[model samples]
Each structure stands twice: as structure tokens, then as C-alpha cells.
Target: MDHLYAMSLDLNALLRDWPFEPGMLKVRKVTGVDGREKLQMRIDLGVLQMELTGRPDGMRPHGCESLLSYHQNRAALAKAAGNEYELSAEECSELQQEGIQYYHRYVSLFQLNDYAGVIRDTQRNLDLFSFVDEHSQREEFVWNFQQFRPYVLMMNTRAKASLLLNDGKFAEAMREIESGRDAIVEFFQKSNFPELVSKSSEIAFLDEWLEEVSEKRPRSKLEIMQREMESAIAKELYERAAELRDAIKMLKASK
Candidate 1:
């Protein structure tokens, strides 16, 4: 009798030697075999294709909707059934795992200069926090996700500021930075993690960025004018806002 020996392959190890550099990431748009459009992040040793909507892989853990949707709907049903809505720790952990997958994709997207994709993914994670906070109300779980809030906000604001800066919207970029800083402070305050609000390196980075941006601009008339217009609008002074808007248009035309 003749016996054949089989060789086993360690694919993960083999992938480490992929042609791409370890830190390099690429986002490619491709049509899947099923004729669906997919956005895929190609990293050093692997690829992650995310769904444009719904869950990343369209995974609904526990045969329920996304943790967010599930809890919202279940909360409604529970109210109707005279029951209370609660998410078990297992479900919370599962949702956290799902968020981790998106986190990987967003980080890769950021490295690849896909800032818009980063914003999109980061917003979805924020929505996850909202859902968990609304339904769970478990201090530990809520705090766990809250602790992650600032980092996501930081990345989101980075993407926003980058886009605005690319568009020559200096004032808008500054506003984004300020908004992100305020959001981080608010999150920490609400969660009773007040000490961390002032201590976070992310907040410090935003402050540094804001200062750098402030010094970089010599107050281009259009930028200054536009900021005034935005302030007017925020204050419900539409007439003044319109006047400033027209003035800005005229200024741009003069230039």
C-alpha cells in the first residue's frame, strides 16, 4: 500500500510576507461576484469589505437586528408588553466586536487618505454608542463605550478638518476642531469622567491643531467674512446672515 503525505499551510503566516508594506493600506472599489458594489480596504495581510449600509458584513448577531436597531425595537416591544428593555453583557460585547471591525476599516481608510470613509465609519460607531447608552443604561457598559467616544470623535474631526482644509475652508476647519473639543469635554462630563476630559491627549492634539491653524491664516477677508456670516446664521439673524453672505460674494468677485 502506498501512502501520501499532505503539507499543511499556515495562510496567516504566509500573508505576512505579502507584497505591500506592513503599514500601507489601500481602499479599492470593486464589484463583487454577486454584482454588488463593495468598498474594500486592502491592508498588509488581509482585506475588509464593508457594507455601505447596515452592519459591516450585514451581520445581525443573535438573529436580531444590529445592536442599535435591535434594542430600539425591543424597547418599543417591551413597553407594549409591560416589560423592561435590557441588553445582556454578551450582546454588548458582541456589538463591541462589530465596532472593532469597523474601527479596523476606518483606521485603514484614514491611512489610505480616504477621509470621507473615515467620517462615515466613525459616525456609525457614534450611533452605536447612542444606542447602547439609550437601551443598556448599565454604567459599566455605557462607560466602556463612552471611554471610546473621544478617539472616534478625534478621528472624525480629523477627517472633517482635512476635507475642509483641502477645500480652502480654513474657518470651517477651525470650527470642526472646536466642535470636536467641545464634544470630548461634554462626553467626559456627562459620564462623570471629568478628570479625563482635560487630560486626554486627543483634546490636546485638537487644541494644538487649532492654534497652528489659527496662526497659519492671516485672516483672508473671505474667511473672516464667512465666519461672520455663519455666526449670524447661528444666532437666527437671517437678515444679517444674508447681508454678510452677499458681502462675501462681492468680495470674492472683487478678488
Candidate 2:
């Protein structure tokens, strides 16, 4: 056997040290041999490695940052030349394959709590979907990628809301979640799939998450006092309600 080939084929020690868990997303960041940071995901068979940025596989298709960027530039040049451009079936397939590379990296990034990276990659995929939808030569090609749009939108929303949540802005996070849900609904409606509004798993996940976050959110002192004042007024306790109202006024004035 060739020595270099044998060495390249061996991964027994690496696999032994990091056993894969069936249902867990095992990911870690490490410096590559070339001294750049990279991500690794443990699978049942072995580990899959990805670059930290710029086209997860580190390939610049057609000398562009990504296939989508290359195609977009092509479309722009075509328009400038007074000619309409459309993607061939082969081009659409190639773009979809490139998208999978991004999908893997973003999913791993999300697990590693790198929400910004997740947002970046997911948004890129969404752009790819839109570009393909508008320029693909066939409706079937458009649907092939459009079907995953809701799930991508959901992940993008979660990442955005999570960044706000990390900054201790629960109200802002809730608003972001609501906006994200509305976007998904709009997508369904635009796709003429209004009946899917109630059955969408992405919407369901956000709904449940919104409830969970709302329940766990901390109430401000003003909110507590206002609630108490409302209760007092409802019970006809004029004196108590008047005292609470005075405190609320002072609180609002202080702010």
C-alpha cells in the first residue's frame, strides 16, 4: 500500500476520541493546519469539516464569492446589455448543491451559539431562493427550492430574535418573533397555499417558542405596579388605587 494513501485513509483514532451521539449536534471550532479557524461536525461515520467563512467549502465558483453572486452578476451584465437572462436547469441544480454546503455550516453554527453566522448563511440561502424563483427557466425548478423557504425564514427569524434576547431585550425579541411569523404567513399566502398557514411546522415552532419566552420574561416594576393598580380599581378599593396611581406617576416621571 502507498504510505501517503494509507495515512490519509486512517481515522480510527479521531473517531475513537469523539464518539457520535445519535440525536445530538456535535460541533466544535478549531484552528486548521493552515492556521485559520474552522468548524467540525461529528457524524456517525466521521467528522465533516467546514471553513469559518466564505462559501463553507472554501470554493469560489466562477471566481465569485459564491455561485449565487456569480449568477447575480451574470444577470446584471445581461440586463445592462439589454438582454433578459434566465438560469438553465443545470445552473439551478448547481446553485442548489452550493446551497447545501451553506445549510450544513449554518446548522452547525446555530448549534454552536454563533447566531450571527447562522443569520448570514440563512439569509444568503433565502437570497438564492429568490433569485432562482425569479430567473429559473422552469416553475418546477423554482418549486424545488422554494419549498424550503419557510424553514429557512424560520431559522433566520430565530437567529435575529436570539441576538436581541442575548442583549436582554425580551420585548424586542418577542416583536422580532411576531414579525418573523407574519413573514412566513405572507410567503404561504403569496404561494397560494393559504391552507398551510395553520399546518406549518415553522409557524407552530415559533408560536410555542413565543409562549415560552413570554412566560419566562421578567416583568418591570412599573408593569407590576400597574397591574396592582388595575386590580385595586376593579375591586373598588379607591384609597389603595389612589396610592398605587401616585406611585406609578412618580415612576413614570423618574424615567
Candidate 3:
């Protein structure tokens, strides 16, 4: 199993200077060996879909030597979510539930061989990254207690731009759409887990959703920030309102 890690290292070493954009592969993940050893696997191309003989080790294979290697003659595994990192149990449950819905909505996307649909739906799932442990939201890490964001936004923006380009926004949304492209690439690069390449967007939609959730009903901590923003707005604090808006995700469904 450990040899898998060496193989992956070799692959990376080979491709490190390929000059191809890193996230171009779209898939990122570590796989355990033959279901018996959880020490290694390969990455690239797409998400982990192998039915290994064993369950996930419940921990990411770490270290250059401890990680597994890529399967022989097999393509590098891609990540289903923009992220390919681990998480806390509670957070994992929430993400899994959301992931199912994402997969279902576009279930036919893949069935019909709609690669675009696959991209859109997959990106949306990653963008809506959620953390049940609310406090963890303050920290922006891939394994931040089941949280999934940043990268998702990048994928979502690209998906949106692709769809929008096909729609009627070609002329009007050019600036934002282009900005999204750069953002998607930028943010993805900064992401961990599946190791999203840098990507960007016009608006951090998920961040807004969280803000709306905090404001619509006001959780204990949210209530205070909500008040501050309201008061600031009343005092002509346009900047403050904008800041607050950017700071939170507007959880309309939470209502």
C-alpha cells in the first residue's frame, strides 16, 4: 500500500513541470489499497469511486511515504466534491446529506452523459460546503469540522459562467463572468482535501447564505452582529452593511 504513495510522488514529480493547469484534472482524493491497507492511493482526473475491499480509514493517509500509490495503468482519481479532505462526524453527516441531494438533482446529468451537468452539480455541492459546528466556520480549513466552501464557490462560479454563457448573459455579465473564471482558478488552488486549484467568483454565494441564516432568525452570536449592522445602516453606515453582508451567508431556508 505504501508503494502507492511513492508512485503518486513520482507522478507528481513527473507532472510538476508539465505546465498544465493543476486543477484541470478536476478530481482529487487518496485511496487505500485493496481494501486491506489504508495507507495509499493515486490522485488526478476525478473523484474516488472505487469499491475497495475495505472501508475508508476514517483518516487521511499522510506523509510522503505513508500515503498509497496510484493503481497501475489507472487514471488518477478525482474528487467528487471540490474538496477531498476529511471532517468531523457531525459535519460529515450534513455534507453527505447535501451531497446526496446534489447528486440526485443531476442524477440524470451523468446518465445522459451531460458532462456539463456533472460539472455544474458537482461544483454546486462543493460551493455549498457546510459545517454543522457553527464555530468552525470562523476557521477556514478543508477539514474544518465538515465545512465545505471556498472551492465550491469557485466551481459554482465556473458552472454558472458556463451555463450563463449559453444563456442570455453573454453581453451583460461578461465582467463578472470573467472575474468568476479567475476566481475559480484562484480559490481552487488554495483549497485542500481534493486540493482544489485557485478559483474565484463575483460573490461568495455560500458566505451570503450563512449571513442570511444568521440574520433571518438570529442565533445567539448572530443576534449581536445583526443588531450592529442594523444600527450601522440606520446611521448611514452603507460600508458597514456591505461588510456585514459579505461576512455572512444568507440562509433563506433556515427560516
Candidate 4:
């Protein structure tokens, strides 16, 4: 197996060329064995597969829960042993690096319209930040994690809002946006970093989204009927689906 692996590397080098572009990025949705939809990005080198939730590769670290879960479990064990929850800089760094990988996957998931996946990954990172802040007690480490909390909250809020909007819950989505902005502001203000809060691009984004939602025209009857038709079909309510389909056509024709 070792010899075969070495030969494969040689073959890869032999086939390699200059001006490589990593080919084109081709994306597709796939359903995993667990019956969840996922996304795969294909390139010349290889294909990258990601889950819609939990870890990007769908692998459980430590053969159980995530790093966040592992830390929490250990913290409990430490308490039982009458020891304090302690983590080195290296452990924190490792967890942070793991988070970066999930961040990449979540970005791709967002682009693929997988808002739930984005929410899952963002929440995981947020949990990590909370865990470090509570346990580490290192001022520098806490400060560094603090810098990312607002951004994580913003991303989580965006994902939640997007999901809500997809379900035609516009009011709830708008509220989520507003609340997210307020949360960021509050976090910074509490930390005595009001300047950082003011400079956040996410605050501007939330404001713009708020304005857009508030000022946007109401959905046309035809549009609403069409969405209802889709919802009925998804629910397998054929009779209701037919009614909504006809209603959509009637509304469209009247327009």
C-alpha cells in the first residue's frame, strides 16, 4: 500500500502542468446516507464533500461529539475530580483552526441556499467562543474570542433570517435582523468597545436589510398563491395543491 501510494504521487506529479487553475468550480446537491441534503464542490484536483449540519465532512471528532462537546464533557469531569477547567494556548489554537474549516464549509453552504447548515456551523463556533471565555480566564484569549463574537452572531442571525424568509415569515426575519444588530451593539458596549461596534460593517448590512424589508412592496396575490401551491405540493396535499394552482392562474390572468 505504501508503494502504491508513492507511485500515485509520482503519477500525479507526472500529470501535473503549469498554469493550473484548479479547473472550474462545479457544485451539486447530494443526499447522504442519513437522508440529509449536502453540497459537493468539484475541481480538477478532487471533490470536496460537506454536510448540511454538524461537521462539514460529517465526521464526529474524537469518535463522539464535536470539539465543543468534548471540552464541555471534560470540564464536567474536571469538576467531578475537584480540578479546574484548564486549556493551553495550543489547545485553543487547534480548536480555532478546526473552526476555520467549518467556516469555509458554511460559506459554501450559504451560497448553495443551505441556510440551516450556515446556522448550525455558526452556532458551533459561537459555542466554542463561549466555552473558551468561560473556562480559559486568560485575558488575551478572551479578548481575541470577544472580537469574533459579534461576527458570529451576525452570521447566525443572517442564516436564521434567510430561513425564516424562505418560509414567508417576513416579520420574524426582520425582527431577527434587528435583534442581531442590537446584540452586536450590546456586546461591544458591555466590553467598552463601542468604537468597534460602530465600525462594524454587519451593522450597516442589517440596517440595509431592515430598510429593504420595510420598504418592499407586498407580494402579489399571484406570487403568494404560487408559493402556497408549492407548499401544498411539498406537503403532498394534492387537493389543496390543485386549488392553489388554479388560484395562482386566476390571479395571474387577472393581472
**Model 1 ranges with Cα > 4 A deviation:** 1-30, 37-45, 60-65, 80-83, 221-255
Model 2, CA-based lDDT: 0.94
> What lDDT would each prediction earn against the true structure?
0.81, 0.94, 0.43, 0.78
Instruction: Report clash pairs, candidate 1.
Output: none
Q: Estimate each model's TM-score.
A: 0.69, 0.88, 0.28, 0.69
Worst 10 residues of 2 by lDDT: 186-195
Top candidate, metric lDDT: 2
Clashing residue pairs in candidate 2 are none
Candidate 3 lDDT, tens digit per residue, 144-173? 423344444544444554455456455333
Tell me how many residue pairs clash in candidate 3. Answer: 51
For candidate 1, the TM-score is: 0.69
Weakest 10 consecutive residues, lDDT, candidate 4?
Answer: 11-20
Give the winner by TM-score: 2
Model 1 per-residue lDDT at 128:
84
Alpha-carbon deviation at 94 in model 1, angstroms: 1.4
lDDT of 3 at 204: 51
| Clash number for each model | 0, 0, 51, 0
